[model samples]
Target: MKKKRIYISEAHKGGRELFYIQEVFKDNWIATEGPNIVGFESDLENYLQEEVHVGALNSGTAALHLGLILLGVKSGDEVICQTMTFSASANPIVYLGATPIFIDSEVETLNMCPVALEKAIVHRILLGKKPKAIIAVHLYGMPFRVDEIRAISCKYEIPILEDSAEALGSSYKGKKCGTLGEIGILSFNGNKIITTSGGGVIVTKTLEQKSKAIFLATQARDEAPHYQHSQIGYNYRMSNICAGIGRGQMEVLDNHVILRREMHDFYVNLFENIDGVLVFNEPSADFFSNFWLTAILVDETKNGGITREILRAALEAENIESRPLWKPMHLQPVFEGYPYYGAKVAETLFENGLCLPSGSNLSDEDRERISKTIQVVFKKEIKNS
Candidate 1:
């Protein structure tokens, strides 16, 4: 029999999604508005344990677009973004006809570098275009240098749009990640720590901000008996059906975080003795990562020329899925010629890093397969050494 393919990350149901989904169907609340939507938002607010509001949306991208709008990012405005993140983080700046000023990452967390961030701010202001907002991300569930970045934001008087899409269960210094910035967003895509089939939320510090987000999301309708629109709006609200799934997923979210951290430990142990392979992990006790996807940095010189690509190919040969780190946006064609700060940290990380299989539903057999495949790849170096 052929071995089943292993994915980098996949949705793991908590067994209660169907129950909530059934409740939605029973009540005929199939559209974007319903009790499930409200319940999911409340569940998220409670989970964060912070005084904040959440507005559920169809996608994290929509949350980002609305977030930029709320931040007052307008045409010709420049937004400072960490280049080493998903394009969704920067695309919103473009959506509102703004330019993106890309910043590099620090080696420790592979997140936005404060030194570079400040440098970008100072230099952009020198060019008569002070950035409107700072878009920082908690890459791969590891919290960014929040305090450091926050200080820069305060010093420069720029707001931070925290992208915690991959960090639902992660925290920094006991404070939740999504609540760290002035405004934040979360993703519940099929591959995230939890799944709402497809959903996200814009997290704000005030009910007024959340209300505005909801209003714009639902087509900016005015309070009238008839369809009346005074401003631009988007069809971005989360469906009741999807929120039902989210309500159930919330029940198992903490357990899933534990499982994902366990997967990170699995990789740490698997690569502990392997030269040239360094597992990505939290830098200190102040950080708690969900380990959304366990990644590694491969040093070819130490591994006798075995690159990350070679390891990725080996995993593919065994029907296991793996992928390279996100290519920094500054290097992509769509973002070329844009203002970029810092040196080659983001570029270097992209060249050397690879994300491994890290799904919460991986069985013991699956682990064995992944472990065996990885070890086999390194054993070739041992033989040649």
Candidate 2:
């Protein structure tokens, strides 16, 4: 018989998702606007606890796009972005006809390097172009160096659009990840910590910003009696049905965070005696990561030629899923030729990193199988070395 497959990350629905969906059905509120949409936003506001307003959208990419628009990013402008993250963080810059200047990662958090960031800022200014915005990511749910990055942002008078798509429950210095910058974004994709099936939100400091985001997201309809258009708009608003799922997921979000952290601890123990296998973790007590996907760095030179690719292939052979870390956006074919800062930190991470299975819904049996696959692979490699 084939071994059961393990997922890298998959949606774990709370029991109450159906209840809210049923409520939507009873109220005949299955469209884009409904009580569930409002309730879900309120739940997020209360949980974020930063006195910020959130605008729900159809996808995280939409949130980032709207954030750039709200930040006054326009054609012929340049935006600074962390190259070590998923492309969604940088794609919106091009959507607005702006250029994305990529920066490298720091080893500690695999996030935007503060030193490199400031250097990039100074260099860009030297070239007669002050970037319009900064995009920083909390990669793999690990909180970045918030104070250092924010200090650079403020010093240069640049607004930060925090990409917290992988860090809903992560925090830095007691502040939630999504509330740390001028604008923040969250994802509710099926593979994230929570699921709205497919949805996202933009976090803003004031109600005015939130209101404007909503206005732009909802086709930018002016208060005219007949249909009218002044500015270009998009149908990016979240549907009530998806918001229903979000409401139910919020009920269990804390539990999900705890479960994911437990998975991280499991990996810590599992790899305790495995030489040259270092689990990605927060560098200091000030950072709290949700561990959205537990990742490890495989140092082949120290581990007898065993590599991330070797382990990834081993996992795949057993019908289990694993993935390499996000390739640096600067290296992608679509983004090649963009100006990149820092040396090779981002490149090194991509060369050696691998994401492990970390679904909150994984069972003990699933973990046992995964562990056996990894153990067997390590044993063979160690013996040969």
Candidate 3:
């Protein structure tokens, strides 16, 4: 018989999703336009503690596309992006026929390094082309150096699309991630802190921006007695059923963040005495991460010759799932020719880091199984030494 497999991050239900779904079905609001969408957006606005506008969409990628569009990014333009995140963060720049200038991450946050950002900006401008916008990401729910990044954006006079897709409940200096930039986006993908099944939301500081996003998302129909259009658009609005799920997820968002943080705490204690495994965490009191997916950097030299890949393979043998960190975009074949700035921080992270199981619904038994499997590998390494 096969052992039970442990997933890295699984969608957790809050028990209220079904109730909300029933409400949507009962109200017969099966399309994208319905009360659920409004309720979900309102819930997010209240939770984020900002008077911001929210536009729900089909996926986080769509939200990014809309953000780039609203930032006036067009063909032949350039957009600066963090290289240490999922490709969604930079692909939108390419979607608009704009080139992405990938910047490396810093050691502290595993996010975009501000020094590299300014360097990229200055060099791009020196070459007679100012970047259309900046796409800063908070990778793995860890908030980037928000203050420094924002200062660079202001100094360069460029808009920023804050990619908070993996950082919905994360915050920096007491402010929510999505609300910190000119255009912010959240992902409710299955592997995220909260799942709307599959959806995303755009956070705008003004109603006009929110209105513009909705117009573009719903096929850019002009207000008329009959369907009219003057601009190209996309079908990216979230369905009512999915919004109902989102609303339910919102009710438990804080609790989910807490649970994910607890998972981080679990890794902290588990690796405390271990020589080579260091859990990724907040650098100071100012940054509060949702701890969406607890990651670790394994120092093979210090830890009995066990590398991240060795640890990952051992876990897989135990029917436990773990994954490597995102490969930096600049190193990807698709983005090779684009300009990149800064040191090898992102490369180091990718080479040594591994993501553990961090689902909110992970039980004590699951933790025990994970801990035991990890201990076995480390013990073998120690014995060999």
lDDT of each: 0.93, 0.93, 0.92
Candidate 3 local Cα displacement, residue 180, angstroms: 0.5
User: Which residues of candidate 3, in runs, are more than 4 Å off?
Assistant: 380-385
Q: Give the residue spans of candidate 1 off by over 4 A.
A: 380-385
Tell me the number of clashing residue pairs for each predicted model: 0, 0, 0
The digit string of per-residue lDDT tens for model 3 on 1-385 reads 8888899998999858899999988989999999999999899988899889999999999999999999999999999999999998989888899999999999888999999999989999999999999999999999999889989989989988999999999999999999999989999999899999999999999999999999999999999999999999999999999999988888888899999999999888888888988899999999999999999999999988999999999999989999999999999999998999999999999999999999999998899888888888888322110
- When summed lDDT is taken over every stretch of 10 residues in candidate 2, the lowest stretch is 376-385
List the lowest-lDDT window of 10 residues for candidate 1: 376-385
Indicate the residue-level lDDT of 256 in model 3.
90
Residue lDDT tens for model 2, 261-329: 999988888888788899999999999999999989999988788999999999999999999999999
**Residue pairs whose backbone atoms clash in candidate 3:** none
Error of 3 at 316 (Å): 0.7
Sequence-dependent TM-score of model 2: 0.98
Tens-digit lDDT string for candidate 1 (1-385): 8778899999998758999999998999999999999999999999999999999999999999999999999999999999999999999999899999999999999999999999989999998999999999999999999999999999989999999999999999999989999899999999999989898999999999999999999999999999999999999999999999999999999999999888888888888778898998899999999999998999999977889999999999999999999999999999999989999999999999999999999888988888888778888322110
How big is the positional error of residue 203 in model 1, measured in Å on the Cα after superposition? 0.4
